[model samples]
Target: MTSFTRPFILAAALATLPLTALADPSVAPAKDSLEIDEPGGVPAGYVLKWSDEFDKPGLPDPKLWAYDTKANKHGWANEERQYYSLARRENSRVEDGQLIIEARKEDLKNKPDWGGQHYTSARLLSKNSYQYGYIEVRAQLPCGLGVWPAIWQLPTTDHMMWPDDGEIDIMEYVGWDQDTIYHTVHTGLYNHVKHTQKGVLKHMPAVCGQWHTYSLTWTPDEIREGIDGRDYFRFVNEHTGKGAWPFDRPNHLILNLAVGGTFGGKTGVDDSTMPWQFRIDYVRVYQKPE
Candidate 1:
């Protein structure tokens, strides 16, 4: 199913000596240094409210995140290939001051809830939800055909189905389209299944191999998305009712790396790219001071 219909949500190579070695470190430029001090630093007028630096190693902090393990049984709403593992370090973990969500090709057939899938990954949802704020994530994306990584949000209220409640795709990248990044917003009145969603595609050639910030500046009036602090996508409150403007309600964050699905599977997967990693340096949310 297309992301638009799913209720559940959830690479520029380095220049190198040889074609295959383009992404190899030996010939590529030095690794992009982490600007931890102020990576996507707090916006000018907003004050930091919460953040996860992944300073402590092991699984993500339980106080800030929860796993969406239920989707493993039926393959989520998109027919994704990987099982969303819970509390499994191999799927999601923190190391060297960063959070890593790794997708691996493995046979989980022996496990009852495996769903006969050959891959395993993780989907993390923030425990705290907010109505509006400046949200930012600094990370390096994964590349290879069939990989789908996303940083997005969904309404926090239960029983609030998609579209009707709203979905915000702060950042989405398909491995097949290595040079572009997508930002989209979905609502009952505007969604992809209907080919009416409000979205934008930005050419970011270095996105997959370097560290960059993906952010959203949301308010009662509008929602703005950006890369590296530069706003590139915006959706204003149409004042047409909840169908078009659900930003007034609180929403929780989600970070996940999915395998071949409707969009990600368009060109088919390269099993050779069996292992991929989505590294997140940090995530911070800021809001106007009360």
Candidate 2:
């Protein structure tokens, strides 16, 4: 599912450390510096378009964003370990021009719990949806065992059923090799079963603790993923019916910080690590032109 977008974070700096942590179940959340919409400026005709400045300090802005509560009860193919709530302070926050999403190893208020996991945090998505456009977000990811941070998109029509509906992982990291990041695409044809891999593994000069421009350029011709404005992976649709790339449909935006599950165990979540933060500077969307 190209779903699960989360905001709320700070600016990250170049840091070199082992990707996984040794389970600290009690480490307090770290502070970050993700300056929100600080006049990054826009290209002419590209338009400022849309964004979540996150300048206010509190819950996510009701008008521009909402939560995918389904994740709290188990959503996405990963079956991760966090319960996503709407605009919850414990999950998301804004301070000093940055938005933060802190996932912690703690019990939740599981009322009508749908087999929810022991982790707690936030997941946010853009209230609006689009099919073809250029979407970009500058952010600093969280680092800790079992920590999974991402910047991606999902169907706008709400593909209630995944796989059949399709899921795209623009950027998904499992905290194992903090130096490496991934960008994957999930579709009906080559899904969790086929063991197909359609992505680019970017080995950043440093881990995600540093601020960088991560984005996607989508058009009728192709879907490309990039970091720092450099294209590393791309996929295109073929009407001839050879390869399968079904990402032309409308999709919404998502930013999230997940804990642990199938993809995270390569290192393992350090449950002892409490309150890990994801800092975001700003999110900007641009239309390629009609």
Candidate 3:
């Protein structure tokens, strides 16, 4: 989940917010922006703050989602071969009550933004940001070599600068390593580059063919990662300094299916799996009342 490159540009509107406003994750959005529907099964003490069921049949709701194509032209941080398309339905679309992020074997040399990549896929960022909250996503993974799917969060700041700003990888999976999943946290003092990241690995045999819920519960005290309501990993706040604990500030969500990256392509891509679909059922975030 630690991209070798710096974070890409987020929404222009988010970048213009005052630092004070951006720093406070407790600052609520307009009440009307809270929910599309009152989601059920929420924990007793937490209230549903935001959600996207992907019930609408079309591109993801623009108000709730934005594309990440800034790194495509120069290739992605991990030498990913996919050219993440911008607002292209072929790469990302909603249908049959699911968000389908498809990775296809193709070239977009004709497009002005095409980055000379052999594959095309999608990377989406949540328009909203959160501080301490419980975030969950239900989805079925795509299988076969070279497929890299991830659900993660990054600092929501225009000045975001890699590990220093911190990253929370709620879930990450590579095709070659079927049924295995990873949950990791990166900060200035701990990261993969330094071989000191806080991470967990789990094996779930039904990971690719079944729908599973991956989640992150974050608080001022610690961050926990879980699958199907069962917690398997936890990173506690040491209260040492920002270098070790930067989760106090707001971070936005990210959903992407990358193909042929430094990690995903360790065994090379399988062309037969030309069009692989990464299906997402829903994304919901909840926060305890202050």
Name the best candidate (by TM-score): 3
TM-score of each: 0.85, 0.78, 0.86
Counted clashes in each candidate structure: 1, 33, 0
Q: For model 1, how does the per-residue alpha-carbon lDDT over 234-279 read when each residue is reduced to its tens digit?
A: 7789899998887776778889998877676668888897689999
After superposition, candidate 2 runs with Cα above 4 Å error: 1-45, 71-77, 110-116, 241-243
- Per-residue lDDT of candidate 3, residues 225-251 (tens digit): 888877777788999999988887778
Cα lDDT tens digits, model 2, 86-131, are 6668888888788898887777665465445677877777776766
What clash pairs does model 1 have? 11-178
lDDT of each: 0.74, 0.62, 0.77
At residue 147, what lDDT does model 3 achieve?
83
The lowest-lDDT stretch of 10 consecutive residues in candidate 3 is 17-26
- Residue 58 of model 1, lDDT score: 92
The TM-score of candidate 1 is: 0.85
Maximum-lDDT candidate: 3
Give the Å error, residue 63, model 2: 0.7
Cα displacement (angstroms), candidate 1, residue 92, comes to 0.4
